[model samples]
Target: MNLYPFQKISFLLVITSTICLLYIPRSLGAEDDEQYLNCSASFQCANIPNIGYPFWGSSRPNYCGFPEFKLNCTGEAPVISFQDKDYRVLDINQSASTLRIARTDYWNNVCPVSPGNTTIEVNHVEYASDVQELLLFYDCPPLNIPLPIQLTSQFNCSINSTANYINYFVTQNLTNSGLTNISSTFGTCNTTVTALVSQSASENLAMNSTKDNLVAVLDSGFGLKWDASNNLCKQCNGTGGQCGYNTSTAEFTCYCKDGPNPSNCAGKKKEIAIGLAVGGAILFGIFIGFYIYSFIQRKKKKLAALAQSKEIPTPLTSKSVATPSTNLSQSQSIPSYPSFTSKSDYDKGSTYFGVQVFSYTELEEATENFNPAKELGDGGFGTVYYGKLQDGRVVAVKRLYENNFKRVEQFMNEVEILTRLEHRNLVKLYGCTSRRSRELLLVYEYIPNGTVADHLHGKRVESGFLSWPVRLSIAIETADALAFLHRNDVIHRDVKTNNILIDNDFCVKVADFGLSRLFPNDVTHVSTAPQGTPGYVDPEYYQCYQLTDKSDVYSFGVVLIELISSLQAVDTNRHRHDINLANMAINKIQNHLVNELVDPLLEFETNHVVRGMATAVAELAFRCLQQERDMRPTMDEVLDGLRAIQNEDLGSEDGQAVVLDIRADDVGLLRNMPPPLSPDSAGTDKLVSSSTPPSSF
Candidate 1:
């Protein structure tokens, strides 16, 4: 056909566009499939004889598997730096998408140069639920007092220990029930390491604690689940093709005998056909639209030139040649206001993670200008005030201190962490003002009743409203909330009776996230300056400056102690040696002087059931108060222990046993035991006031 210039240009443009679009995808797909033959061969090491897909090594290319899943087959078994740490892969279950791996440095020896926790940094990798952590304490000073049975399982790691220092290994199931009056004798350790082992293996090692047993556990390794390209791999295999990753495109690709396919081998030809057809149709439409636009622009210019030649500008001015100001004047003359729509009345509200964002004025009015009468209580970072929101909902507004750098950090940290977390026992976050507001304020659901501290020893102590059942319920709920927080990787650094709020209905609400921290997934603990309530702080955390969820366990231990004794955590009026409640608790429980610590109001002398429950709880508290963080049970363990003590069904299908040793009748037999050594004669009455034997609840 004899076509004009525009037609010829349009034809060439359509052909070029179609060619580039159709050729690029095909070329890329061809390049990606180059490794099809190479990846078809499975990876093999000495023990792991056959592994494929999502794990490439040695002879395999990068496109064969995920970058993070690459293995180093140079050694006897497959070695992979799964999460920035070298691990020896013992076996792989392709069907289950799991791996059995052991730490390389601790293969034979229990000591490592820079021992670290096994952390899963990649999204695809996760420790199986059946994995349990084993703790190793190294280079601890020999105690002047005899070591407790929990710490007696000593292994001499000469590399990390010396004549003056020794090493010890303990499992997660170990408790501090055997600890004597040795709280003062607990010494600091140089290095603490955490290792993972299968739950079955850990339970099996519960009775045996020799060095060889621990080394064998490390050699056996634990489990990990890999979910890389799960669906894609299934689809690829179903279509009789091999599944692989395309590093260039950062996507899953299917490899067939013919070539690489975007999805599956069976659809390769169909996909290419569709791509070409769609590209051609799109290019033809674009070509037609461009031609029409060019013609119109060209015709307008020609008409303007002809009008100028005829010296007639009226039609051009009236129809098309309007000045910028003239156009603006016409728009202004339109009836905009009469039919104008409003912008849906924004109440100056915003949302963060589904948490409402309030204005400064609204919060100020809700708090009645933060009146002193509205003051609720003081907190780690700010003061809380009772307020009612504009929506007629009661709330507790936390007004932080003036705009300091730390204040801003805490404000943001609380908002970010609280908004994402949802637990029935946890205090609900309603909203907060913007970071750029006149002042930073956080609004929470109002918990009308006072804190647990108020009932224990503060304003509400005389009421004796906290009975044995109520106290036990509080402990379970608090542990539950803390466990939920730990599961979500949150550590409530300041855990005390004061931080435990009691609503009007007596439900426990754990507040105060200012001192809480979002623990890093890569480490067992975070190394930071210890900041917690004085009597409730973890002694190990304070000494070593390492914070972990176990620190919360230690603090909760003090809270448990408070519930049983109704004694303040810090009582200066008592014996000088009994200043800190945790220290007094350790001494009394170890010396069989529990009779001295029980609150008289709990009726330890008459109620045998309450006595038994109290003693069992005391034992659990002692384990939590262990000088070593590893000796303390996890929050989940604490919850399980409490549930077991209360004889309540925990709703767990496995029905995990409580590790604590409780002796209900052992409480009243302390009459023959000698009195606790008192350093101050004047405080003797205060220490020995309660003669009723402490019992288990």
Candidate 2:
């Protein structure tokens, strides 16, 4: 091992085909910049921005990139992949400003020796794409967890035409925990991973090898970036902060940035005092207390009327839902409480969870004396206000607007509903206040991510589109929440992605239970007025007014369709013949033209997931759209089916042995697909309005 000989051997690592591939640079380090830009554009080779280190380009180093960084274009739909680990390639995430990739189970069920490392042991990854960027996604596994690893080192770009179809792969001995961000939506086995390119010769020869393992490439966002000398998020002269924009509501709050307080932002609301007397005159021992007390009471009355007028022109009035027949008195009519509770005090103090009543004066200050700027969103029961609590917590406060007996019933129902429910995916109700508004006021934890509808359609956000797999995961998680609701005998009369709010990690929470109903014992169902979105509304409910758990099922089916197509529930364009999504999907399917109904974003996806989505969603939408009240799957059954669809296995080795079909009698409204179309009638189906169908229909 002489120094001269060692240097020669080191040079050989690049030339050797078995391991290292020598990369030349166009600018400086050939081995670092160009290697990871192979998958920036199409599955084929394209002009990518060559950037980064430890990965060189195949072409010129300075002008374009280096040679080692050059990626190969394999198959008809050419795919960009790593030179050393051809099993993986770059996955472009347009929103996160980075690239992402999963490990390949190249040695499927064949490992010679186990890597004792418990963490995710991905030693080296190939950095090559048709395009280039400096962002990446990497969450390596720990070495301690023993994986049930198997090896079959088969790799060749030309071997599989649809190599990208294999999204998940198996590392035989790796525990479930070793898989970063592992979700139940995709199969649980480490075996769910797939390689970007295929290799036949390696697989054939590895059969007799004593030890074999698949070392795949991963293109996390950072792989597309170059070494930063300073900082990436640096501002020109001012400090930097996380992105945020909410002009529609004229409200925006970004993350903390550098300044006098490098880690805090501007916002404040005074706290309300606790358990203090309503009126006190200790300082007026001899100063004619009568005049002072009268003046204060008159001023208080005027202020009360003024605040109510600012937010609502009419006096505060609501029915006490607990006694649906009896309406509650307006706040103006209630006996006046003392002024001991101040707005400034409570604004700085955190509001307690589970039923904290805020005095009228305190609420006025929190909402800027009912300033128009504080409004959030309003609905059937009341208006919601986005306010800062005394404790410095941001909260959404729903103020009940009751003037009649029915409104009172609804108010009571909301209180009972919030108290009885608790789940990770449900909004948390902090204490409520009967004295704040006409009837009651409910405060909830603020979700920064906003509603699912905001991401899919809002014009303010940029990183909102959902990747295929991510959409599947969202579908499954939402189904789980609905399942919980059904299990507790609650019927979510209105369900839509708009009602589903998301969190930082993309967790889903169903909101706005304004129309929700509790299923009573001995009563299988109840009759109610028509509710829900126009297109998503159940035809049966409109006809007979009979509402059941299936009402929720129908609404969820519409959500599924919306997610897959990224289309609105209501498509009123005259160009589209005024056909709604339900009719559009049915017609397209009947014509055997499923492409017209599915999303275009999934054009590159392999396996049944892409093509199969139309069929699955169509079927669900069809069942939920049934014109008969007695026909349709229950929320429980729909949830199960949706979950199964979410965790579907694309690879040959993934599915568990079981049939998840709803039973013959159990299959209600969704029992059949679009009515069998006649050959001559397939071209088009007449569109119908939702109001055309009734419950008895």
Top TM-score hit: 1
lDDT of 1 by residue, 382-435 (tens): 677767777789887877755122334456677888887788888889888876
Off by over 4 Å in 2: 1-353, 404-410, 435-439, 574-578, 604-609, 613-617, 650-697
- Candidate lDDT scores, in order, read 0.73, 0.46
Q: Write the per-residue lDDT of candidate 2 for residues 460-540, one digit (tens) a residue.
A: 125434555555556677777877887888887777776777665667777765337787767878865455666777655
Question: How does residue 452 of candidate 1 score in lDDT?
Answer: 81
What number of backbone clashes does candidate 1 have, counting pairs of residues 3 or more apart or in separate chains? 10
Task: Tell me the alpha-carbon RMSD of every candidate.
Answer: 16.4, 30.7
Task: Compute each candidate's TM-score over C-alphas.
Answer: 0.47, 0.43
